[model samples]
Structures are given as structure tokens and as C-alpha cells.
Target: MPLFFLSYSHVPVHRAGRSPDFDRLVFRFFEDLCGHLAAAGGPEGNAAGFVERPGTPAEETLRALADCRVFVPLYAKRYFTDPKCGRHWTAATTGPADTRPAVVPVLWTPYPPAALPRAAQYDLPAMPGDGDEAEEEYAATGLHQMLQLGEELGDGRAGRITAWLARRVLYAAATVPAPPGDRHVPGPLTALDNAFTAPLPAPPTLRITVLAPTEEQLPIGRDESRYGPAAEDWRPYGPALGPLADQVRALARNLGFTPDLVAFDKPRAELRGTAVPDAPWVLVVDPWALENPRVADQVREFDAVRRPWTAVLSVLPEDDPQTKERSERLTRLLHTCFPRFLREGRAGEQNAVRGLPDADVFALWFSELAESARMRYLRYIHSQLSAGGDGTGDRTEGRP
Candidate 1:
């Protein structure tokens, strides 16, 4: 078993529009911390600490958390709210409070002291010198932010602080040695409450509608390779992406949106005349669907209409051979069909509704789509409220 289990929340998606470096820095911090721990532990520290990654066996995590000598938690806003992190913490600190395993809290991000939960706070030893300026600064900046501002992993406060943390973990292993614990936590880890609080309000909704044909409905010569039972299962991106609807749902969840998947068979009346939606909507469109007169009319009607809260995304996978051969033809068809989408004057950024080449591009574009819909909705509602009317803004007459 490893000497320490590095417990932290997993960030699932690369947030849209932010520099990718934020997540890179986070991973680099973890690697550096592990390296520091190993160096401090000497020849015996080959596997000085363990951090879980995707595809790591659950049993391995169960054993490491149960058996490790020290519990090193990486604290951040995400860390507190993640139920998985809570389970790990609960499993590691399984016994009586006084005799619980040694814990070394690694601050990755700062949280207001009062906003902290009992799980992290209760474990902290009540040491004096509470008003110290250096401590306050350290508390405020967090180890991760310090790292972001050119703090090297091996020198200065960042280095020294990490080095001190490593030594403490090593010392805990020596003085309070613990053997590999049984794999079983007292109960199911899933039942454990999250240690830190996630915001209480219901998350905003992102409605996703997949418009495509089922295998049986494909036009004469079209291959049925990627079509599943329904429109939601239309995987224009091929086998690798599975279904676009599911992918959008996962991405939506990562972005803190409650994804509501609407069927393509939804009434046209409801689609056109709705006064306002409780959530923003994204349409996952496969070019094949445009062949069906009904689907195409809906697509064109949706496109020509002035619904800022709706973002239409045309998916024609780049890697798929069938999709590649027809990509240009399909895109041109879209341009001709939906003149408003192809029209040029679309604010500062690229058009929010347009072609997405593949799943990767789809993901990137979907992030923007979600944000665009959200912002447009907010902007419209705000306009209505300021004009001394109910906040239920409708888009019966305008150009998006």
C-alpha cells in the first residue's frame, strides 16, 4: 500500500473559453507533490503517495484509502462538494476521532474559513498564532494559485511549503504507522455525505434536442451504421462517440446544468409559440435529418426564426468516411437552407450556430453554445424586466 492516499475531486471537462493551463497546473501540482513526498521518504519511498486517475481499479482505491498511513486531502471548492472525495475521507478516517489516521490537508484552493464544513474543520488541530499575516496570505492564495504565478515546485514558499507537507506525511507514516486496512468501508462509500457544500440552488437547465433519423427511417442509399433506435441515438460521429445525446448530457452535467433531452417529435406549436423557457436549449443536428421534409422544415423554421436561446449545431463527423465524402455538400445545403445562420454579422465571436466537424469540435462548440444560449436568455429577460413587464420574454418578431 502507498504511504499516503491523495484525495481530491476530479474535474471532468475542460471548461470552455478558459485557458487549458488552469487544469494543467492542477495536475502538475499533484505530480510535484508526489515527487516531493518520494524524495522526502528516501529509498523506501518508491510509491510514496497515490493519486487516482481514470480507469484505476476501484479495489485499488479502496485498499489505498483504507491502508495508507496518512490521508492527504487536496482541498478546493470542487473537492468539498465531490461525493467521491467524501467517501475516500470517510473510509480513511474510519475510526474514533482521537485515534483516526494522521491527515495532512493540502490546500489547493481557498474557501472562506466559516464556509468550511465539519469534515475538514473538525480534523484540524487547534494550533495558536491564528492572526499571523503569512498564514492569512497562504490561506488566501492557495497552493494551486501560487503555482500558477510562476512558483517553481522545488523552491521558495511554494517549494518549502510542499517540502514541509511531504515531511509531515513521512513523519506521520513513521510515528503512526498503519497496515493495509480491509477493503471494506464500514458501509457503502456511496452513501457518505459530501464533506464540503455544493451550492444549494437548483442548477440552471440546458435543454438538448437531437434531430436525426432512426436506422429504419434512413433515406434510400444512406448507411445505417451509426443510427440507433431513435433520433437521440444518431451518432454522426461514429462508434467512438457512442450517442450525441448522452455525450451532451455528460458535458452539460459537468458544466452544472440540468440537461433535459427533448424528443424530435415535440409539437411544432410548442416549439414556435412558447412564451419563455425555464432553460436554454441546444439542438444536435445530423445533416441526414435535413433530407426529411418534415425535419428540414423544422430545421429551417428554427433557423430563420429569432430564438436567441436556441443554438443549432450541425454535426458531420470528420473521421467518418461517409460523413467526409458528403461534408461539403451537406454544409452548403445547410448554408442555403438556413440563411440566417450563415449570415455574417454575428457579434465579436464566430457564429454560435454552425457546423461542428467532429465530436471533439462538437464538445468545444457545445460549451460555447451553452454559454451563448444562457447569455442571450439572460440578456432578453433583463431587457424585459427593465421595460416594466413580466420577465417572460418571447421572441415572436426579431432576427437572431
Candidate 2:
């Protein structure tokens, strides 16, 4: 078995006082190391370890050191100056006559090895190259050098310590493990010592669906009724409609709706044939062939997969001289085609550059929508729980 002997800055409780917080951090580092080492060699590769000389007798401590094939020295700012550290370093690193265990030094803090007293610094590996001052130079240089020298010198310090540990500590570093299930566990190491203990990213709340033109060279319409001169010039609305759907989804999110965004782009018949997931709210922007009466069967197909409570934002071009006429025609077409919108929970909404007076108006409206949505969702959840599923009360109708 690959045995690791861990040594760190030690503060005896009677000598100093209570255990400093740094001790916890050092333990966490070793814990993580164990995990990494196990992953590299498999369960059989993992071996028992100790941080300090743990036995009552000096002989017992010596025996533990004898069994240790790898000695991991952890360093920090105080490590160099502490007297106990000096003794521990001598015991761990000083070879007995000719035989010695490989010594791997890991610097937890950024202080330079040069800062260590001459007696303590001697016999260590050469110092790494200098780096930026803003960065903790010693830690970065030392760590990179350590990783480069992996498994060869029998000197414990080399080769991908962080990466190796990552795989070992969290089984299969290929995927991030899900967080703890119940009550939160206090980290073995605090933030001052370890980065791995921080909280993971929250899962995404909104899904975005991006819609773009299906074909590049579809001819401009010949009939004036199809669209005016601008409509004929409307090469493809998809490119212009990129961030607009995000803005609409932001509005929906603020209104207490969960959004799942999907992207559809041009020249792909797959987009035209695809189905949108059933959501409480959906925003379809610049649906490329959606307005063509010939594609009514294709357009209304969204209703087949969606729920009754869906709010659909159907985006079409207002790119003609008669903007109002185009909008009115589009609205009527949506009403006729998507019969789902005529129901109680479903509604048709539209957005255009014209609706926003300026950036200020847009910002204010967006903020208001988000606030209202959160408040509405909160009230709905509260009501659902309180009314025994009847939803009987007015639900925060008049409250200040």
C-alpha cells in the first residue's frame, strides 16, 4: 500500500492555547489528499496515515515514521517560524543514517521558502521561479513544480497534486458530485485554507429557446399584401432577434414564471419540425415561416405539446411601412391559429423596439416585472399551502 506520512504546523494546546483554526484547514488538506491518492491507485492503493507523531512514546512515533513511505510536509507562514515545526521537519526529513522516506512539501500559504530560517530551509528542493507579486507567488511556483515531478523521485512533492487529489477525493473528477442531502456539514477546511469547500452553482431556473431563419435564400415576397418594401428587404429576422427573447424571458421570470429557453436557427428543417416543451410560459421569437399561412399547420403544432396555462410570446416582423396594419394582422392570425390563447390562463403578448421608449424605460419595466413575478409566485405558493388546495382566500390582495 502507498502510505503517506502527513506533517503540518503543530500547536500543543497547553503550550499555545486552544487549537487555532489553521489546524482544521491542514486536516482538510490531508483529507482531500487521501481522496486523491485513493482515486489514482484504486482502493488498494490507499493506505492509513497520520498528521503528527501520534504515539505516546518517542519509539512509537519512530515506528509510525518507519512505516511511512511518503512524508508530506505542509507549510504556511507560521510554519517557518514555529519551534515545534522545526523539530517535526527534522524528524520527518532527516534521513536515518542512509535510509529516508521521500519528502513532498506542499505550501498552503504564499510565503517564500527563503523566509524560513537557514536551519529549517536546508536540504529542501530548489525554490521555484519567481512570479507576479499580486499573486501568491510562492504557492503557484511551488505547486506547479510539484505537479511536474510526479511519482518519479519517490520524493512525495511532485506531480499533479491538485488534479490527482481531485480525482481521488471526489470519485471520478469527470463530473461534479451533488451537494450534501440534508443538514449542511461544516467544512473540514475553512475558506482560508481550501477552495473546494465553497458552495456549487445553483441549477439553472430558466431555459432559453433561440429561433432563427431556416433558409438563407428564400425569395422576397412578390405581393404587396405579403409585406411592404421593408418586408421584401427583410433578409432574415433571426440575427436581429437574438437577445430580444432573453429580454422577454427576463420579463416572464420577474412575473413569477419558470422559463425553459430553446434555440432554433436557420436552414435547418429540424427547427421547423421540432417541438417546444410544455411550460407555464414560452417565448418564440421570429418564428421563421410561422406567419406563412401555408405553415399554419406547423405553427399551431406548438399547442399540441403545451399546457393550458401557457403564455406564448409570438414574435413576427413589423418590418413594413404599415406597422400597425401588420401587427393587427399578425395578432388576428395568432388568435385564429393558436386557439389555446383564448383560454383563461393562456394569453398572447407582443414586444417590439417600438414598445420601449428608451433604455431607461426598458430597465424600469424589467425590474418591475421581476419584482412583481417574485411577489406573485410567493403569494401563490403561500395560498396553495394555506387554503388546503382549494386556493380559497384572496391571497394577499389588499396587504401593504
Candidate 3:
């Protein structure tokens, strides 16, 4: 059984939503790592067992750290500089610098090396999202070096480092011997035969309706191979249609729901346009036609025959007031000028992150839409019903 020590800075106090997201991401990563380890033989037929303890100085926390075979640090902007973070860093690196119980550091953001005051051995890359070309180039080189280090550390190094988790960390919680002087050492949940089991929740069915102008405005093309050109096009599909179908398909497999997709097109020449059907959930992409304005004429034609639907506009962040004014104007048009709608814009600078050069900003924007749609749909399905008897339940789902 390998003992891993995980540490990070205290959760930010500003955002209430961020804490849950932060904790969920961390725990999910651990779960994924364990699954990978179970595929290997490291954890004695059982997956890696772990005891997730938050950062604390309690006796229990100390005992676990003393026995930890690996030290993992969650490297963020404030983590290396914070006093609490500094103490953990010192303990992990000192007293046994030569020993390889696997010390790993995972960066939350691309921080500059100059910012690191804790230990000088590690070299951080230039911060991404700074929108500096020279900094980005420097960051890319550092990222490559970090990946190489991770490859070198192998599985034995389960520190907070990105390289530490290059493979996966497995634990045999069942194999953990009871600590000396203790009546019983609590084993992994697997020891009780309940570790890997989760009661399947009955997945509620949710409808995802796309209220786009027409097929011409947002084309749906498939590839010969499941993963050819069509697959590539699908990356940008979220801007038009949210990931409700994909999410419904994935979640319903575990729950229950038949996902229905409706597209507004000039289906019949006799019928002027399509009328919006009563759907529990309706998503309006490009609500204001900000990204592509050429399709605005078609959108107007569709809106001539409108139904009560939630609208969301995607905006481009601009540093200048003029561009910002233009973005706000379009967003306001979709909100007040249209029906129930919300507008969302992203920082243009996010596209210029140094470390993630291979990752395109436009691609990421689409990805965010897809992911947000999936999560929003899940919440919508679980909410109470609306008085209108529209399948919307209590969950009024609309995300920009």
C-alpha cells in the first residue's frame, strides 16, 4: 500500500461555487488515477487505496504524512508563496532529498519561475493567458521539460507534480497493515466490499432542443470514419448546439431519458418556417449572431415566428471600450430585445496562454459551451417542476 500526501492552498474565499468545483476536480482526478492503477498489478488486485485528508496540522494529518510514500503539491500562484504551502514544501523536499518516495508538483496555472520563493530547484514556465508572445514561447519550452521530468519520475513519484501522475498511482487499501499501538487500522472501503460500488441513480430524462435559424446557418455534417473530418467539425459544433445530446446519452445510460434534438430549417416551402415545440429545455446558440453575423438575416426570419425559449449569446472579450461597447450592445439586444436570454463572453487574452500553445482558444471556447451544456442539463433535470407544465421542471436552464 503506497501512502500519498496531497496538499494545496486554502480554497479562495471570493467565489462560493469555485470551492466545490475545485474539490470535485481534485477528487475526480484521484478517482481516475486509482482506476488506472487498478488496471495494473500494483495495488494487489485491488485499486489504489487513499485517505483524502484536507490540509491541516491535526495529529491524524501528521501521522498520515509521516507514513506517506509520496508527496504531491498542488502548485498554484499562491501555493508556493503561502506560508502553509511553504511548510509542506519544505517538509517534503528536505530531510530526505535523496530519497525518491515520489515528490510531484502539479501546476494550477503557468506561473513564472521568478515567482517561486519556496524551493529554487523547480523551474516554472511563463504564465499563460498573459498574451505575451515571447513569454508563451518560453513557457512552451518549460512545459516540454516538465513533461520529460514526469516521464523520468515514473509511478513511484506521486508528488503533487504533473510528471508524478504521468502514469497513475495505485493503492492496496486492503493491504494496509494496522498501525502499531492501534487496535485496528481502518482499511479501504473495498475491505468492507463497498469500495468500488456506487448505487446507480435513476437518470431523469431531459430534452435538449436547438433553436438555431436553419441547417444552412449551422450545418450538421458527419465523416466517413467516426473520427475523420466530421469529428474535427464537431469540435466547433457546440457554438451552435450545446452538448445536451451527448450529455443526455452519457448520463441516461446510467439514468434514463430519450434525448430529442430539433433543428429549425425551411423544411417545407409551403410552411414559412418552423414553430418552436414545447421542450423541457431549449438552447439558443449565437443568440445575437456575434461570432458570425452573416447568418443574422436567417435568424431574423426564424424569429418572425418565435416561441418562448431561453436565449444565450456568446461574446468576444475586448480590452478597448469601443469593442466592449459593441459586445455589450449585442448581448443586450439578445437579452431585452429578445425573450428570456443571458449573454456570456470570454477574455480574448485567454486564447494567448503561453503553456497551452497546442490548445487553440477558439476550440476551447466551443469545448466550454459543450461542457457547460452537459452540466446545466444535469441540474435542470434534477430541479423541481415549473408551474407552466413545460418539461422544464423547476430548473430554468440557460447558459452562455
RMSD of each: 18.2, 22.8, 19.6
Task: For residue 239, give model 1's deviation from the true position in Å.
Answer: 1.4
Off-target runs (Cα >4 Å) in candidate 2 are 12-22, 42-48, 53-59, 95-98, 119-161, 164-400
Residue 344's lDDT within candidate 2 is 29
lDDT of 3 by residue, 139-255 (tens): 333332333444476522222332224232222122223223322223321222221123333333334333332333332332111112221122123333333235334442332
Error of 3 at 20 (Å): 4.5
* Candidate 1 lDDT over residue span 10-120, tens digit each: 766565346544457656666777788667643244366677766788877776676677777777778777779878877876654333456666667864322346555
Instruction: Tell me model 3's lDDT, rounded to 2 decimals.
Output: 0.36
Candidate maximizing TM-score? 1
Over 207-312, each residue of candidate 2 has an lDDT whose tens digit, in order, gives 3343333344222442233322322232222244334545556655554445555543221233334333222223343333445655556556654543322334
**In model 3, where do residues sit more than 4 Å from their true spots?**
12-21, 44-57, 96-100, 118-120, 123-400
Least accurate 10 contiguous residues by lDDT in model 2 = 391-400
Error of 1 at 157 (Å): 36
For every model shown, what is its TM-score relative to the native structure?
Answer: 0.47, 0.30, 0.31
**Residue-level error in angstroms, candidate 1, position 232:** 1.4
lDDT against true structure, model 1? 0.64
